[model samples]
Target: MLHPDLKAQPSRRLPEHGLAEAVALAAALPDLDVVGQDVVRVAKAVPATLFGSGKVEELAAALRAAEVDLVLVDGPVTPVQQRNLEKQWGVKLLDRTGLILEIFADRARTREGVLQVELAALSYQRTRLVRAWTHLERQRGGLGFVGGPGETQIEADRRAIDEQVVRLRRQLDKVVRTRELHRSARRKVPFPIVALVGYTNAGKSSLFNRLTGADVFAKDMLFATLDPTMRAVELPTGFRVILSDTVGFISELPTQLVAAFRATLEEVLEADLILHVRDIAHSETAEQAADVDDILTRLGVDKSVPMLEVWNKIDLLDPAARKSVEDRGAASEGIFPVSVWNEDGLTPLIEAITRHLDEERQHEDLVIPFADGRARAWLHEEGVVEQERVEEDGVHLAVSWTARQKGRFADI
Candidate 1:
């Protein structure tokens, strides 16, 4: 944990003052709270060894004063840099990527998520095996009593990791199949799915709850909604649909995470439409939007799926700026500015969604025999019967619904 500052100092990836976002993320970890106030920085070229020499000395002094146990670096540090820093500072140190992976490893609850993290960790470890080596390879051949020469620890670790990787891949295949089965089940009923997607901590969960009245753990924290939450919602006029609050997108989202959460993200890929609920007030709103769009591209949803730019948290925006944003979006594609907290500007947003869904709606005028009570009931239960009348020859009905729902009444 070398405290680094690059604000006044300059560097390629991040300057001294440029590391606030990086450090802010590091500080979010509760486990690092003990050293939160003690972390320091050195913004210039990182020494090949410690990445911080003078800064390391200062950090050592500070740790001694603060009685700290660890140093957390906000940027990537090579294995050599980490080991050198530890050896010099006589304290544990961690880099950004390693710290994030550790958090994911600890928080992973599902089988697929755990396996994905383990695979990423194994891959990361394999690259830095330099941290571990042994003298056993220099040993002479084993005695004749032994079956064969013992393998070096490095070779053994590699083989074990490879075995685990293969096992995880097989397990993930089963998980994928299970997800596909659930998808098929949902398709049979065929309620239109709407997915909430946006930057981490962008209030996706809050908007989700506001729209569907579903109580999900909505919090002002990064990755607050890790698991996908689904609820059945009846829009005004009894228009039923399925609403899904899927995992939020973020900048530089770890590849391991994207792969592990594929099952959850499937909601977005398969959604009838995606609501990009963004925090319009954040300073990085534009950048966050770009990041979300980039991830959408990676998910192959950028060009394929219909996306609605939902500028959430409008109350936080200045009135003038908010008006400007809404006005800019007014003439554009699917877009709406709304505040989920105050429930302002939601009617139009919901209407916009219904309009998008209109394309999926099928209308038909059909007549069922007067004696066919079952067909009449089917039409009422499955399709939205816009009009119904009774005549001596048959029961006449005008219906609008999805093709799947229409199929349910094909017998009529």
Candidate 2:
């Protein structure tokens, strides 16, 4: 893995940490055995080779000595640059986006996930086809002067990819519609949704398992959980919530992925509460949190929707550090310090969630006309009706519900 630290680059993550993350990303793929990793400082990127020829030769010699089969570049490598690097190093090469796509392809399990991965991969592959063919002017037999063999091949390949993309999109659209129907069903259940989101390997899944008691694929690896998982969880205050565990975020996440996974992330948009879990022990926790927030913003998550910061992995911290973190959390609003593995400080976190939910609830008295049976029934179905009284002109009721539920009732 090589992280090219270009000068004056604006990035949220430190270059060294980015390099480490690149190594972790490379290690996420089971087939690839990472033999070497380094941070390559590039004062300026060469358009053709990314790195200077001398630097490329130096790295090529080192890779040869290490017998590396693949070189994972931790930053963007143009198609031309990738081809040049592969030729110089005499090894297969993958850039940041390509590496991420590979990991997503390997980790996706659901049909929708598979479709999204394929679409994203095809989108990425379409861009690199420029380097796929060698001959650009060799003539091919055609009905007319339609250009050379290379142009024909490129056109045919792109046409094929376009067809595949269209098919995948059709399939994905159907899946998305089905998912939307499911979401609509959940909306009628009166259970608030709480989405867990964070940086990759930040223990979001472990926290999810601890809360919901469902065995999801939780591991100490980057992009461990690609598909979203949800389970109904009853809070301490008897309020039921659907807990959603989503794919983790990363720095410089591929654009294709962000666009492809938008449907998967719609759960976050629909969430009544979002738990921004953080690996509190990681040195780049703040940076990671910022990345998650940035992605959330890009996804158009409503600012009005409440969010809580979860300082997770406290077990890994020393006692003093843990106590300090706890104190910091206590001093702040919407912050909880907890170790999911040790099950420490969970009570407060759960209580905080309950408090946030309760804070959103408003008690009101409504007068529903006797003819409006549907509205009264909805209030009853939502379990927010506290008391009811029959009157000559209408039905008087005392109810408690959140703003969302009230809006839903008004729609009814």
Candidate 3:
């Protein structure tokens, strides 16, 4: 449901354009099956409650009438307010973060993704602990399962939750270790990683499938691609880079989710290049970029790292928009436009990716003695050797590599 925040103030009216953008965002979450919706318009001086008593009553009534199993708030709700509202309404109340987390939980299919979602869920549940267990005041346990040695319900539930949390963490730690091993194997191969990051519904998964020819689950829904998928793509210059499609960013992302997905997002921090794909046709394109950049900054990735902005979804834009995105924004060096659906205007984007990779890589010329053929073979296998010439006593080649790679070659 679109929130009241997107509404234009009537007298001090905002452009009605934002409404369409909000609808687009909502449309992206088709998998949510978001049944019941309520738009609670708070006053200029909104109370800490966000929703007033009157609105709360109306919401409770509507929820009862609709039999909505879930209530999704389009904005952030404090842990205290969330617990209070759930009690007041007698139904599960989920804020934007909770909805996103639920979406992630549903979308996550891989081990890493499952672990990340569990971590995020645990973190979120930790904060709202004060609210969830208060119903345990009347501890009456008369069930035959415990042979009449039944403990108070609240205490029993708390113990169970604590045990589950501990078990979940241990399992997550094992998953993290498994991820590290996979990461190590990739390092042994040592391909430069190019990560696609952008706002949800920006066609990141589409671009990833387009570039790598990998059929990942790409849909119009928000958070559709929760598990990170990587594929090897060969550039025009025969350079094979690993392209990863990560979970999309959104404005006001939950801190719990961020912490939960930190391990997954390490793809961005460790990447050689980032393709900042955007839904250029969206009216809030600028705001979307700001949200993505904000997350990047918090990730502590070097601002100076090379980036290629491949503004996507040109097919949805009008002729005027296409012209503006292609011509009007003469702002940056590597910004290009593409439509992943129709395969429109992708050459420039690919070229920019190649250019960024070339610029970031360090090139060198090295000669290895014939006696050290193992070193020569290792260099050829691991490093990006541009060219090699066989000599009477040695192998000579030009190589472009990372610092770790260069050090390994030097030792050889």
Candidate 4:
């Protein structure tokens, strides 16, 4: 893996840290055996190779010495640059976007997850198909208006990609509709959704397992949990909520991926509460948090939805740092510093979650018509009906419910 540190560009992370992240990204793919890594310095990005010829040759020699089968570039590389680099280095080359697509493709398990990864990969592949058909850029015999330049090889490849994209989107839309049906059913159940989101390897899965007592795949690797997982749990306050564990965010995530995986992330849009988990022990914790926030914004999450910052992995901190976090968590309103591994500072976090949800509830009076037994039953089923009485025209009831529950009742 190579992380190019361009002199002309400023980065929030140090070059060495960026290189280490690249290595971690490569590690996410089980088939990859990362034998070598480096932070390559670049005064200016070469359009054709992204590196000066001399530096490219030097790195090529090193790659050969290490018998590296693949070179993962930890930054954007143009299709031309990728082709040239592969030729010079005598190995397969994947840019940051391509590498991420590989990891997603490898880790995706569900039908929707698999389809989204394939769609993103196809989009990435379509761009690289540009130079592959350069030699066949010629017109073929066809009607002038019908085929334009007679559908060259690149055009054919792109057309095929477009068709595949359309098919994948159709299948994905079916999957999304099914998911929406499930979501609609859940909305009727009166349990609010609390989604867990953070940068990759920030211990979201571990926190999820701790909170729900479900054995989700939790590993100390990037993108370990690719599919969204949700489990309904009754809190200490006896209020129930559906806790969601979603795919982790990363800095400079591919645009293709952001678009393709939007369906998977729609869980966040429906969340009544968001838990922005952070790896406080990471050197780039702040930067990672910023990335997660940016992606959430891009995903069009409603700002009105309540959110709590979960400063996780506190066990990794030193005594002083941990004490500082504990103090900050105590002083702050929406921050909870906890270690899911050690089970420290969790009770307060759970209390805070329940409190936040409960605080949204308001007292409401409703006179249900005798014909609307379903709505009245729903109110009783939700356990929010504090008082009841019988009236002349209908059954009068007093209920305490959240705005969402009130809306659901209205729908009913």
Per-residue alpha-carbon lDDT of candidate 4 for residues 4-83, written as tens digits (9 for 90 to 100) = 99999978889999899889998888877888788889999999999999998899889889988888899999988987
RMSD of 4: 4.5
How do the residues 142-234 of candidate 1 rate in per-residue lDDT, one tens digit apiece? Answer: 544432476455555666677877887888789878978988998776778888889877888998888887788887766666667789877
C-alpha RMSD of candidate 3: 5.6
**Where does candidate 4 stray beyond 4 Å?**
133-149, 359-412
Estimate, for each residue in 96-192, the C-alpha lDDT of model 3 and write its tens digit: 6777777777778988788778877866765565535566555566566542445665556555566777887788789878878988998885778
The Cα error of candidate 1 at residue 321, in Å, is 2.8
Query: How well does candidate 4 match the true structure in TM-score terms?
Result: 0.87
Model 4, residue 231: distance off in Å is 1.4
Off by over 4 Å in 1: 1-31, 34-47, 132-150, 189-192, 235-241, 360-374, 389-396, 402-404
- How many backbone clashes are present in model 1? 16
Please, what are the lDDT tens digits per residue for candidate 2 over residues 1-412? 8999999576776888898898889889987888888888889888899889899889988998998888899988888888878877888999999999999999999999999999999999999877454752243454434544445666767777999999999999999999989988987756778999999999999999999999999999999999999999877644578999999999888899999999999999988999999999999998998898889988999999999999999999999998999999989988899999999989999998888765467889999998899999878866788899998989999998778777788788
Candidate 3 Cα errors over 4 Å, as ranges: 2-38, 44-49, 60-69, 83-90, 131-134, 138-162, 329-331, 359-412
Best by TM-score: 4
Clashing pairs in 3: 28-221, 28-222
Tell me the deviation in Å of residue 367 in model 3.
Answer: 14
CA shift of 261, model 4, Å: 0.8
Arranged by lDDT with the best first, the candidates are 4, 2, 3, 1
lDDT of 1 at 53: 67
